[model samples]
Target: MNKPLAERLRPAKLEDYLSQQHLVGPNGSLQQALKVGIIPSLILWGPPGIGKTTLASIISKESNRPFYTLSAINSGVKDVREVIDKAKQSGGLFTQKNPILFIDEIHRFSKSQQDSLLGAVEKGWVTLIGATTENPSFEVIPALLSRCQVYILKPFSKEDLIKLLRRAISEDDIINKKSVTLKETEALLRLSGGDARKLLNIFELVVTTESTTSVEITNEMVLSKVQQNTVLYDKTGDQHYDIISAFIKSIRGSDPNGAVYWLARMIEGGEDVKFIARRLIISASEDIGNANPTALVIANNCFQAVTTIGYPESRIILSQCVTYLASSAKSNASYKAIGKAQQLVKQTGDLPVPLNLRNAPTQLMKEIGYGETYKYAHDYKGNFVEEEFLPDEIKGTTFYSPGESARETTIRKELKNKWGLKYNY
Candidate 1:
């Protein structure tokens, strides 16, 4: 049988594992558990090609448990139950010897399918290990998610990827037969996008395609051997991040046509509707802001609607919201204001709240000058009062400068009218 380079290079023991030292290191969280041979039901969350499955396999072997595997893309509730039944027969309940059930892409499982595993997991019939690229809080059902401890796997760093490449060349039986030199790796690293599997696959392709056994890998050689633009949209790869960036930028730039085109690409590529909708909500606030307050309401509704009505139908809702946001006036004043305020807080660590602004609920607190001499805005003529809200030390700092949009321009005039240059509005 012909096996891929990534599969053949998979590490069977924790000592052979490359990255994720925080979890598998000497004093790591899982290190103690692995040493004692008692593994917990866990949800391994991370990007693609980051060793989630391999880590799960190592845990099962180290714990000396029977291993059962299933892919959520193909398996249904029935398949889940069958595996659980065999696991129950294989070992005792609540024991370290319980079978380890590994489910890849557990986020893809529907509510009913996930519900099927809850009983098996709760009874300790199986030590469930689920791997997901999506956030478990959003994708996994709450009941099932609460039952498993979530361990995040970080993306491979540039140094980590380079170490993996060197290990492959020196250790692989087939590759060691040939003389391979990595003259350059910029193109290889860029193409892999921090994914180890993609990196090795590209490296192997570059090596095997060469006519001679002596392979000298360069940026040019690697790029030429690997096919570019083959994948229209890779949900697990670079296109997932790049296309979303394009889609958001198009909206921020007020190009409705560009926005809809990128949206179409994502929709056709099977990008998660909720993921697309969530970005639109952020753009509505951070990009559109007070320029058109209605944009936020529309974007928020788009999220609620799409989550309820998924796929083919949600695409129309997404297109409508995308076009509306692109056509609306834009502003980043609110976003910048919060950022500046946060920076100020960090600089002036926990300044005391002004006495007048403090609430006085009891007689003892009232005597301490809380709410003393504080003017009520409602008692004023225009339902506004010139009160100092910020700490006295940073009293006159102006963080929010209204953007040059019609609505915000009106707001600028109002602020200038109220404070009379106190904030230099």
Candidate 2:
């Protein structure tokens, strides 16, 4: 039997590895460390199919270090200790080389399970390389996290993915035999959502079912294949990306019907309810910003309610949020405002802050005009005052432009009354 395309194409050397140029490229931190023949205890934080495991294997092979693996999901404290004991025996006292222990899904490990490896890691019996989809700060114990350097792996870009597809077509034993023409790669790429493993699987599926080598793959064919395959909802894979995209777009398009439909798809597919809820909360802030402030409050409440009540019942909480956010007025004014402000700061460099807005904790700062012309808005009628708060270079520059929505109408009115043409109200 042939190996899976993802497994077959897994890079065995640093040169074969794609993406993550920052880590494995020339003069990169990992590449530099490899040149010195010193491997640090580290964590690979990223989405699935980005080569965390493959990178660990390459590191161990290239460095000539003994390698051990433990799954945080299935391995216990005893398994951890046994691996440590074996590593110590292999290293001995005089040996400079240490075994590399790679823990997959390290976030799933309990506090006690993680604690078991701390001693071995601290003693240098083994170099720890942990992989996780979650933020290490929240999932990993502080003591263990502090000892290991965390390297983030980004999703593959379109070019990187196209390169992988080309490589698979020419290199893979099974795939190379098949003559296939990729007529439309957008559907395949969109379906895979930057996951190489998922991409290859879909490619293989499409080719295997076709009668000829020169078969053209279409979006319809891809959809039919995916619908037939009823695989588990891999929260770390394509499904996660697809569902979230649908959810966000549904709210953005103001289609409560579509939003609820995607929400149901996620729920029926057994997606992590919390994960869906978290996306909803982010969507509220990002897509529904300012236009409907209540959207965020409701989304946040839905997240809390889903956490308190799990499964079957939580679907209702999710539905309420999806519908409410979809029907509400939508705007990204706050989000765009921050982006504009950030760009201005970068282009203008760090302009000196207005003296009136600066703190005057010391007498020297006050003598330099710090807080000298500051206006206290609270001391004025209706807590309103026209004062120059921005840096002198950007005194009247406007960042936020309120959208033409009901909630923002009030904001537009207030700004028009206060700053008038300064804000182009």
Candidate 3:
């Protein structure tokens, strides 16, 4: 009997794991700790198919620890206690050693289930390795979370996914013998959306279905295969990234028609309407700042409406927001300003706060010249007084260059009127 694709390809060691070089690479925190035989209780947080389970297995193997497993989806408090009892019995083998208890989908475990494991973990009877696709801050109880170090696993990069596909074709027992030619891989990679398991599954389906020895995987073939199969639209997986990408690009390209079309795709795919609305809210600020400040307000209101009302009715609210945002004049001045300001901060190190601008909460600071040279803008005419606000090391450093748009034109004119050559770049 052939094992499942996911099972066959699971990385059994750190060397076999594909991405997360920052964590599992040589000299990485996890790798170093494993070498020294000091494995901390940890929580692996990431989206599915990014190899969280594989990492947990690798940790247990490399450390030579007795490993026990549980699933939050199926395991209850009774199961947790059973595992804890087993771990306690196993810990007696060595004076200093304890068993490693790994819990998959730990986010699904209820408060009581998690509470049951606290005593075992606190006593060092077991080193808990918890994996969750959800944010651990919200799902994992504070007490349990505080006991474990959380490591965030990023989605696999394009190169990483490609590497895995090549490995599956060349290394896997089932597909290795068959000759396959990857004519076009962008569509496959894009469709997979950085999910290694999904990439391999799709590859298996494509290669197995074809009759010819040398198979060509094309964009059309991929689309056809996906369409033929049950359209499993994962809100937290590939479809989430793809739909959101299309939605953002539509607004950026100023095509309300395309924007609304993607919006419909997401809605039809059973996407969480609130998730769609949340992305729109972000697009308003990041992609559509200043040019239409009202866009943010409208997007916020749409998000609120979607939260209060759901389903078929919320689609209308989302449509109104998507269209308005796509049609609005767009600028990223505020976003750009922050980016530039952050870069400046990193470049110049920390500069002393200007004396006049410093708050004189204490008499000692006031006597030394805090607020000494300050001039009240409101006290002056038109609430206009130009003085240095930046640190002394970099005074009058211009960061925000307003983009040319109807909305920003007024801002540019006002800036020129007030600061003249000081800010007129």
Candidate 4:
């Protein structure tokens, strides 16, 4: 069998693992766990090729515990249950130290899938080590998340990448047989985007593709070799964020063509259908707020439809919603209003509500002036009454300014008429 350079060069021990010193150093967070052989359930969150899997393997090896690996990309609840059952039998049944179960891309697991692991984790049937590139707080269930210690992994620095390249040349038998000198690394590092496995694998490709023993790797040579291999959509790398950025920008810019094109890119790339729909829903509110109130309704409906009907069919519903959002009038008035309100609340902490605005459920509360001088709009003409709504301290503040659109222009006119000089914008 032919093994890739990344797999071949996988570090086996903690001392051999590079970078992530905060998690594994002698004075690191896991120092006691590794030394005393008491492993806790942990969640390792970071960008790809940063040694989450390698660190888990090293911890297992150092602690002399059986290691079970599962990739969330291919594994489901059944696979998780089978592994946990086997782990329970292995050591968790008769010992305090449970076998370590390492799960990669753990963020992809659904709520039910995560719920299934709760019993085993709580009972010490397994010491779980979950790895994810996404933020675990949002992806992992609160119950599951609370049970594990989440440690963030940083990307490898230029100095670390250089060390890895030299180490590969010195250690790997294939590369050691060839005369591969790291003459220039700027192109290699830039293309790899701080991913250690990508950095090493790209270096290997540059060396092996040369077909000659004496090859001095240069920036120009590395770029030429890696240009064709660069992809536009990698869920684990920069392309994932970049493409989504473009998708949102297109919708916000009101370019239906661009929006649909990027949507197709995400759909073709097998992105989580729910993930795409969720972004669309946010964009609708943040980018197209009250300018066209129906946009939010449509975006919400699209989200529900896509969640219920996934894949090839969901693409049509998403495309429809994207075009509608792109064609609608844009405004961030609601988005801005909420932000300003939050800032004001922070500045004026727990300011007392006006007597008119306070609710009085009891006679004593009403006697103390709660609900005093409150106007009933129905008793006034046009069901409108001008009254003190804000606190006396900041009574004349204006937070919600209507955007310039046919719909909001009408709303602004109505407000000015109702408040007279108070809303005389």
lDDT of 2 by residue, 1-425 (tens): 87778899999999999989999999789998898888889999998788999999999999898999998767998999999999998774334479999999898777789999898888888899999877898678999999899999999999999899889888988787887666678878887878888888888877777777776667888778777874722444457766779888998899999999988888876666767887888889888899988899999899889877878999998999999999988998888899999999999998988888899999999898999999999999989999887887887788988998988989999988988777666
lDDT of 3 by residue, 203-268 (tens): 788787788777888989987887777454354345767777988999988899999999988887
Candidate 3 deviant stretches above 4 angstroms: 1-3, 32-39, 46-48, 60-147, 154-163, 179-191, 213-236, 254-257, 267-277, 298-320, 361-364, 391-396, 403-407
Query: Which parts of model 1 are misplaced by more than 4 Å?
Result: 228-238
TM-scores, one per candidate: 0.93, 0.81, 0.73, 0.81
Question: In candidate 4, where is summed lDDT lowest over 10 consecutive residues?
Answer: 231-240
Measured over all alpha carbons after superposition, the RMSD of each candidate to the real structure, in angstroms, is 2.2, 3.9, 5.0, 3.9
CA lDDT of 136 in candidate 4? 93
lDDT of each: 0.90, 0.86, 0.85, 0.87
Q: Which of the numbered candidates is closest to the native, going by highest lDDT?
A: 1
* Clashes per model (N, Cα, C within 3 A): 0, 1, 0, 0
> Residue 32 lDDT in model 3?
90
Better of 2 and 3 by lDDT: 2
lDDT of 2: 0.86
Which residue pairs overlap in candidate 3's backbone? none
lDDT of 3 at 75: 96
Better of 1 and 2 by TM-score: 1
Candidate 4 lDDT over 230-312, as tens digits, reads: 66214444456677899999999999999999898888777877778888899999998889999999999999998788888
